[model samples]
Target: MIEFLLTLAILAGINVLLACGFNLILGYGGLVSVAQPVFYAIGAYSSALLSMKLGLPVPLAMVLGALIAAIASFGLSLPSLRVSGDYLVIASMGFQLGIIHIINNVEFTGAASGLSGIVSAIESPWRSQIYAGTIIAICAVTILAIRWLVTGPYGRAITAMRNDEEVFASLGRDAVHIKVTLFAVGSGIAGLAGGLYAHYFLFLTPDQYGIFSSATLLTMVVVGGAATVRGPVLGAIFLTVLPEAIRFLNLPIAVMAPLQGVIFTGLVILFLFVKPEGLFGSKSGGGLDAWQSRAMSSSMRKGAK
Candidate 1:
């Protein structure tokens, strides 16, 4: 029971990290990216191969994996500057499919059979607790770092761009740069989460990081209340544990698998209809928007004075 619970906790932590990245892009940047899983795959594969094949230390490999993802994000961003909304989503989906194909065909990636024997930084018996703790600590640091970023000048700029890119442009702000930067940062976060996931499981499979995983992460961000810090974390925990809780029903594998999907999809649809802003999110706007509004109001008051 303890082991099961520990596994749940670790998965929740990873999902939280994933959801946070989605939140930054979809929630704050107002960019809908369907290619997140591709970046995640890249991270996992890069980290695993580096550690397993190249003998690099786990931490260094993880960092490099994240960096590679961030760099890849720039490629997506260039195209994004040309289109947005549904078109951007389609482009992202294309990228996702393309990457999956590459992973499946690439020999070094184990050609769809998946890669195994990934060495965990934390060794056995104590591995579970230590890994869970490390992930939690990483999540905490990420949350704080993201909070700081979203409250600063860049956050305000991105908020302006999200609300009205034309207005932001009229104010002489470079909306393109902000969007690209946020997208890269979000991808980097996803990559970091992927690295952790690879090491935790000590295995890699192309199928594991497919469109379904992207949908799940996106669902986490949406259900948790996209722009808020606590929303994704809460959503990740709920979704991660909810599936395990359902298993206690002892339903057949066929029945159980579809049932979990049905439950999760129903909840997401319900949330979309009932509270689109999410549990912790504001109906008015995201955290960035709130800060921007306050700043503008204060300036206006001073001008009046």
Candidate 2:
């Protein structure tokens, strides 16, 4: 039971990081992207390959993996600047599909066979406990960092951009820079999660980081309350644990998997219809209208000065 609990906690921590990344772009920056899992796969593969084949230390490999994912984010963000709304969504979907195809076809990625033998940083009878602690600490620090970002100047600019890009530009803020920076940060976070995931499982498979995983991560941000610090964390915990909790029902394997999906879909629909702002989000009409309004006022004041 303790081992099961520890596993659940670690999974929740990873999902927290993933959802936070998605929130940074989709929730705070107002960019729609479905390519998060691509960065995730990059991070996983980079970490696995570096540690397993190149003989790099696990920690260093993880950092490099995240950096690589951040750099790769530019490929999408640059193109995204030309589109918005549905078009941007379509572009992101294409990127997601394209990356998956590359992963499946690339020999170094182990192609459809997947990679194995990921060395865990923590080794011992206590590895589970230590890993869970590490994940928790990382997640706590990340949540605090995200809180800081959302409350700082960049946060204000992004919120303003989300509300009205033209107005944000008119106020002397460069929407392009803000969007690109947020995208990179978000993708980097996803990469970090991926590295952690790879080391924890000590295995890698292309199928694990597919469109379904992307949707699950997005669902966490949406259900948790996008644009809020605690929302994604809460949502990640709920969703990560919910499936495991359902397993206690002892339902047939075929019935259990689809049942979990049904429950998840129901929750998402319920949230969309009944509480679109999410549990922790503001009840006001716009997603972050209050913050945007304040930002606009502040910008106006600066202009007058």
Candidate 3:
């Protein structure tokens, strides 16, 4: 039982890393970039190829992989910024499909066979506790780091851009730079998650990351409530463990997938109906007490023009 619980905890932390990283783009910067999984795949493949093929140390390879993903994100940003809303989503979907095709067809990435036998951060069977502790520590550190980031000057700029990009630009703040930076940083976070996931699973595969996975991450950010620090983490943990809990239902593995689909769809619909802002987002959810919701609503009504 302890062993099983530990596995759940580790997966939960990973989901937080993935969700929060993408939150920087969707929630804070309002960039709505749907290609997060592309960077994630890039990170995983880079790490896997380096570790398995080139025989590099795990940590170094992961960092390098993340950097490569960042560069790729920067490339994606240039053509993407001019497009926004649903149009931007369509372009991002195209990019994702194109990238997945390249990944599956390319020899360097093991083509459709996928990459396997990668290393993990955990070192020993007896040291499972230590491994779990290390992962939890990383998650805690990330939480603090995000808190610091969201409360600082950078946070102000992001919130401003989220509320009003053109107005922010008119105020002499470069909205384009902020938007692009948010997208890149978000991708970097996704890359980091990818690296961790690759090491955790000891394998890499193109199908593991696709449009649906990207949508999952995006759903966490959106339904978790963008513009709030706690939402993504809360949502991540819930979604990560939700399936694990469902696993104990004693259904066949094939039946399990459909059950999960139904569960996720229901959760999404319920979240949208009750607290469209997210379960833990906004001070109204459980934080400060103010008329912020009214203010947000008023701003939206006026900004529609």
Candidate 4:
């Protein structure tokens, strides 16, 4: 029973990391990216291969894997700089699906069959406890780091850019730099979460990091309240536990899986319609508008005309 609880805790920690990293771009930077899971996959596979194949220390390999994912963030970031709103979403979706397809076909990634026997960083009998504690610590640090980031100059700059990219650039703030940097940092954090997940579970499956996973992360950010520090943390923990809580129901196996998906979709729709600001978000200026800024859409359309 303790082990099961620890497993839930570890998964929650990972989701917190993923959701918080994503919040930097989605909540604050006002960018809608469905490609976040790709970075997570990259970090997981890269860390796993490094530890399994190269025989590096699991911790070191995890860090390196995260760095690799951060570097790959440029692929989406650069192209995305020219697009906004629906175009941005389409581009991110394309990137997300394309990368997963590549992972599916790639030889070293174990292709469709998946990879296992990943080395764990903690080998003690109390492995679950240690991993759970470590992940929780990492999540705490991540939250604090992100809080500091979004509350300081970087945070203000992101807000300015989100509100008016043209004016921000005119003020010599280097909008490109901010956007790329934000992507890199956010992707890197997701990568780290991926590493933690890989080492803890000691397995990697391509299907686990697909579109639904990305949507789940996005839902956490939105439901918790975008552009707010406590929103992602609260949303991550709540959503993580909600699915587990569903297991208490007297439902069958097949029904449970689809039911969870439906619940997630319903939550997003409900929040968007009923309380777009989320539980911890402000009622104005930073809710759904932050997800896909109407201003950005208008500007993009104007530029195209």
Candidate 5:
């Protein structure tokens, strides 16, 4: 039972990394970066290879892999000579698919067989605890940084760009710089998370990362609440932990996977209908801690009255 709960917490932490990392781009920047999974894969694969081949420490490998992946994302985000938004999304999706294809075929990554001995991703029993704590802390810091940015000159500039890039340019805010910076930061976070995932799970594969991975990351942002610090974290934690709960519900193992699917489908629908703005979204006005949010909401309502 403890093992099961431990597994759930680790899963939740990983999702937090994936979701919040992706949120930097889609949630805050309003950019449709469908290639986020690619960066995640890149981080995982890079760190894995480095640790296995070069005998590097997992921590160093993670940082290096993340930095490389971030640079790659920045390169990919260049204002297209012709593409934008959905078109960019399409392009990024293609890139993600292409990366998977390469990974699936490559011998270095164990090709179709997938990588193994990823326990190396977690150096020791304490490694998992430290990694999880570190990633969760990263989420909190990211939220604070995002909140500060949103409330400050730079963040408002991002919002201005989101609302009207042309108008932002007209106002002399250098919208291009904003876009580039956000893209880099967002992808960088994804890369960082990817590294941790690689180390924790110690196994990665081409199929493990694809359009579906990107979609999941996006879902975390939307379901958790975009444009807010706490939204993605809640989304990641809830979704990550729920699957584990289903697995442990004393059901047949064979049926558990599909049961999780049904639950996910239901939750997605419910969230969309009841709170599309997200549970912790800026638009929704807060983070988790239902009691605190309730208090804040009451105070605001009273203030309005």
Candidate 6:
């Protein structure tokens, strides 16, 4: 039972990082991207491979892996400059799928068979406890950093850009710089989550970082409240526990996966329609509705011009 609880806590911590990382991109930058898992995969693979092949320490490998993911984020950020809304979504999705395909086909990535034998930084009888503590620490630091970032001048610029990119640019703020920086930092955080996952599971598979995983992270942000410090954390913990809570029903194994999917889908729909602001989102109806409104306004302005 202790082990089970620890595992849940660990998963929750990882999800917290993933959701918060994405909050920077979507919530603050108002960029719609579903390619977070790509960075997650990159971090896991880079860290695992470095540890296994080059015998690098797991801690150092994780940092380098995160750095690589941050650098790779430029690929998406640069192209993103030319796209927005649905186009950006499609582009990001295509990028994600393409990366997954490459990982699936690549020999060094272990192909479809996946990679294992990830080294742990600490060898102790209380490894699970230690890992859980480490993840908690990381989560706290991440949340604090995000809070600090979004509450200062950077945050104001982000809000300005989100409201009207053209106006923000006209005011002498470099929109390109903000976009690139947001992507790099957000993707780097995701890479760190991926590194933690790799070290904990000691395994890697392309399937683990799929579209569904990306959706799950999005759901977390939307459900808990986006553009808020505590929202993603709440969403992460709730979703992480939700699956385990479902298991108590003792349903047939076949129905379990589908049931959870239904629940998640239902929750997202309910939130979108009834509480788009999410459980802890701003009272101004922020989530997807705000995004849609902003997009439509931008389009109408463009048409008028």
Score candidate 3 by lDDT: 0.76
TM-score of each: 0.91, 0.91, 0.89, 0.93, 0.86, 0.94
Kindly list the per-residue Cα lDDT of model 4 for residues 62-95, writing each as its tens digit. 8999999999999999999999878998999899
lDDT of each residue in 1-305, candidate 5, tens digit only: 65556656777877777777677677666676788888888878888888889888878998888887888776577844247757888888887888779988989988888988763654566765665677667767766776687779887777667655655788777867777777777777777777777777767778778776776777777788776677788898887776666665689877887888788768877887887677766544432222234445546767978
lDDT of 6 by residue, 248-278 (tens): 7889989998998888777777777887787
Models sorted by lDDT, best on top: 6, 4, 2, 1, 3, 5
Give one digit per residue, the lDDT tens place, for model 2 in 50-152: 8989999999999989989999999999989999867988899899889888889989888899887788878899998999999999999999998899898
Give candidate 1's error at residue 240 in angstroms: 1.4
Q: Which ten residues in a row have the lowest lDDT in candidate 3?
A: 285-294
Model 6: CA > 4 A from native: 249-252, 289-293, 296-305
Please report, as a residue range, the 10-residue window in candidate 6 with the lowest summed lDDT: 285-294
Q: How badly does each model clash, as a count of residue pairs?
A: 0, 0, 0, 0, 2, 0
Off by over 4 Å in 4: 291-305
- Give the best candidate by TM-score: 6
C-alpha root-mean-square deviation, each candidate: 4.8, 4.1, 3.4, 2.6, 6.9, 1.8
Which tens-of-lDDT digit does each residue in 1-305 have in candidate 3?
88888778877787787788887776776665788888889888887778788888888888888888888887778898788767878888888889988999998887888877787765788455775676678778877887888789988887777666667788999888877787777777777778877887776778877888887887676666666788888888887777667877889989999898888878777776776667676745321111244356547878986
- Once superposed on the true structure, which residue ranges of model 5 sit more than 4 Å away at CA? 79-81, 119-122, 125-127, 282-305
Q: Please report how far candidate 3 places residue 79 from its true position, in Å.
A: 1.2
Candidate scoring better on lDDT of 1 and 3 = 1
lDDT of 1 by residue, 1-305 (tens): 78888888998998898888878887788787778888888888888889989999999999999999889898788888888767988999888888888899989888789888887877778888999999999999999998998889888777778766766898999988888888888899889988999998888888877788878887787777777878888888888888678888889999999999898888877877887766677766643343355456657767978
In angstroms, how far off is 149's CA in candidate 1?
0.8
Using TM-score as the measure, name the better of candidate 4 and candidate 6. Answer: 6
Q: Give Cα distance to truth, residue 1, candidate 1, Å.
A: 1.0
Regarding TM-score, does 1 or 3 come out ahead? Answer: 1
Shift in Å, residue 288, candidate 4: 1.5
